[model samples]
Target: MRTTIRLLLKTYRFEFIAITLACLAMAGAELYLTSRLDALALPKECQFDQNISVEQGFATQPEEPVSDPTLVDSCQEKAIAFSDSDQRSAVLMSFGAALPVLAGILIGVAVVGRELETGTASLAWTLSRSRRRWYLTRALLVGAILGGVLLLPSFTANILEHARQPLIDPGSSFNDGGIRGPVLVMLGLLTYSIGVVTGAVVGRQLPAVIITLALALLAILAFENGVSRWESTLAEWQPAASSSYSIDIVLEQDYRDRASGLIVDQGSVFNAAPQVDGGPDGAWIDAHYDSVALVVPGSRYGDVVAVETGAIGAALLVLLGLGLFVVIHRRPD
Candidate 1:
């Protein structure tokens, strides 16, 4: 193991250094952004106005009209400052999230693909008695390093996420899924697995990196959209509120029959309602149906994260197995 580690460091010193520096920069930026966001105090009016209820959703309204012009001006200034800081933090957070993924791809492909491309794999295979052991030791070592380096940035991203939304629970909110928490580390591992498989198959660094990136993007899109649809299937109906939190993921909106407790088609309700002063009778519709929304609440965030993590873990295992198979069978030419 120590020999393998030394060999890996000697072979990919530049990449290791670059990735480490990038991760450190991401962590620093995230911390800086979080401090900036935290320093900007929320105005009393803004802070007090923001309220959230599971049944009623967010209820944000000023308790009383501002009579003092100076106080009103101060509140507006603070609000604007907070908004600007929040936007900056969000932008940096996104960039920090992508750093680990890119690092994983680079490390994974370069580890084996470069060796194969440069005709060094033949020499390495000649030195090692067992190809399986050789590949596993080097790959696992690199993966562990990548995962360890990624933790710093991932932790900072979590802090920034919470700083940006101090009122909401980051754990329960799915607003930024892969950008923070354990999901980021899992995503990094998944991408590394993708790179290793692609590199093993392609036998070239640059092409493997390209293919790995494309595959990773497609996987991410599929996960995001497909999981959203799946979450909709698991969605439950809740009372539709006039206002909603930015963190909430509402899947569908419709009305429920008050008497039958069944969802009423919105178009059908509008069409069946009697024409009143200008359009459908608002009074009649209100009396017959109550507004409802199909929502995947924050409470289910753990379940959603678990499902996504499991899927990614499964993909990683498959990719790693395939890469190992290729390494064992393929000739180092």
Candidate 2:
């Protein structure tokens, strides 16, 4: 076992180091971005300080509101215009947040697919180690490495997710769906497992990498949209507030006439159709919302994470079963 592991390490040392550095760099960049966002949301209250430049008269003075002038455009504007850099940060964050999924694909290809492609896997099986032990050791080592890579970024994302500026859209929350720390880790595992299974079935590195990545993307989309579709069946419907409530995981908010109880419009806080003839009027929608359905409450964010992780885990098990069949039936060569 030690020899196999050491051989694996010797074989993939460069790849492992590169991946570790990339993960650390990505985590650092994310933390830096989170700090920038935190700075923007800093309160505008005055502070006394010796470092203040009395002549410049700026340091001791309170910081100006980071929100743009257009915030007066409407209620929605207030929510949307918190910072000019917010939307940009959000876009960058989205890309940075996908690092784990990307990491999983690369690791899968390098660890399993490439080995099988180069006949190294067959060579390993011929050694003192049994084929089963060889495969399992490789898989477990890769899993442990990926899991360790996840720790810092996951913690950073979770911390910043909760401390996000109030004006940022709830849907954009870092804690949502696959974006959550634990969920991302599960997704990584699922993607890695898919890669291993695909490599075994295809017996080629390039094809396995392509198929595994494609399937990983499909799985992510499925989780993001597919699982949420069940909200209507599972959510608790309550009377919509005339005023905006704390925006959490609201599944549906329906606008209805108070007197006739006729449904006027319905959607999320950001995209709800207005009762009026025109597009959504932020003020009007706020006043007219008569009911809402809560899918997953803010307090139960952990529950949603568990459910999503379980769903991913279930899919992983299915892939594992298929892979087991392939490996058991086929020769390593």
Candidate 3:
């Protein structure tokens, strides 16, 4: 056990240094942003929550009382107008965020690939360390390093966004932008893990690196595009029709103002359609949205970024299982 520990510590020294620097870099940016947020006196309400950001809020007044902008030009204008300042930080962070994934490539080359390519492992195994202990140590170090590879950019991005600006309820983009962080981290981890597995399988340095990077990119794109299709086709379950209150939103005083606080209209929001009746067994899919309400006095609804934490976790587990199978099957047989 002690030998195993010493081997991992020595073998993973570079990985440890990389994760430390990345974390510090992220933490430094985050702390800077924390001070900035204080300086700006950002309100707690404006801070985004993952759950609340995914939903729509009561409309804020349009610069002009434009009817469903999405109606006129497909609301391409709304999406376009904000493109410049909208996600600049998030976009920039993504590129910077992908750097740590390179750690995987380096470690991949160093760990199993180097040993196997040089035929050094056979001699090393003749020593105190068994082949199993050696492989397990390598995998453990690579896994820990890969996990950190996934976190740095996101932590920095979060800090940058909060510190740079007080996330001032940037309309629909808030939730959309918030979702990007987690998705990007997943991208990084997926890429890193691919490198680790490929390195373990292929003993050559350059070939292993190339294969891992290519497969990682493909995996990221495939998953992203697939999930997007799923979101678009989601058939929102509706509720049964009933007599209930609804609000009449209007443009007033240069704001998309709520005419009244959930004004009691005779029509039931429940029966908005055949599916959602605004009540249980209804089509109002957003009922669990008790977290926040439509545009209230101080708060706004973020795009409901309903990420299934469990699902992402499950995907990681599945990939890990496959990796383990591959590793075990390939052992010196």
Maximum-lDDT candidate:
1
Better of 1 and 3 by TM-score: 1
lDDT (10s digit) by residue, model 3, range 271-298: 3324524344332323322222222111
Q: What is the C-alpha lDDT of each candidate?
A: 0.80, 0.61, 0.48
Candidate 2, residue 161: Cα displacement in angstroms equals 2.3
Q: Which digits, one per residue and each the tens of the lDDT, describe model 2 over residues 22-127? A: 7678677667767765665433221121112212233433234335444323424323433544565556557656777777777776665676788876776677
Cα lDDT over the full model 1 = 0.80
Error of 1 at 172 (Å): 0.7
Q: Score residue 86 of candidate 3 by CA lDDT.
A: 34
Candidate 2 weakest lDDT stretch, 10 residues: 46-55
Better of 2 and 3 by lDDT: 2
Name the candidate, 1 or 3, with the larger lDDT value.
Answer: 1
As a TM-score, model 2 comes out at 0.72
Residue 156, model 1, lDDT = 86
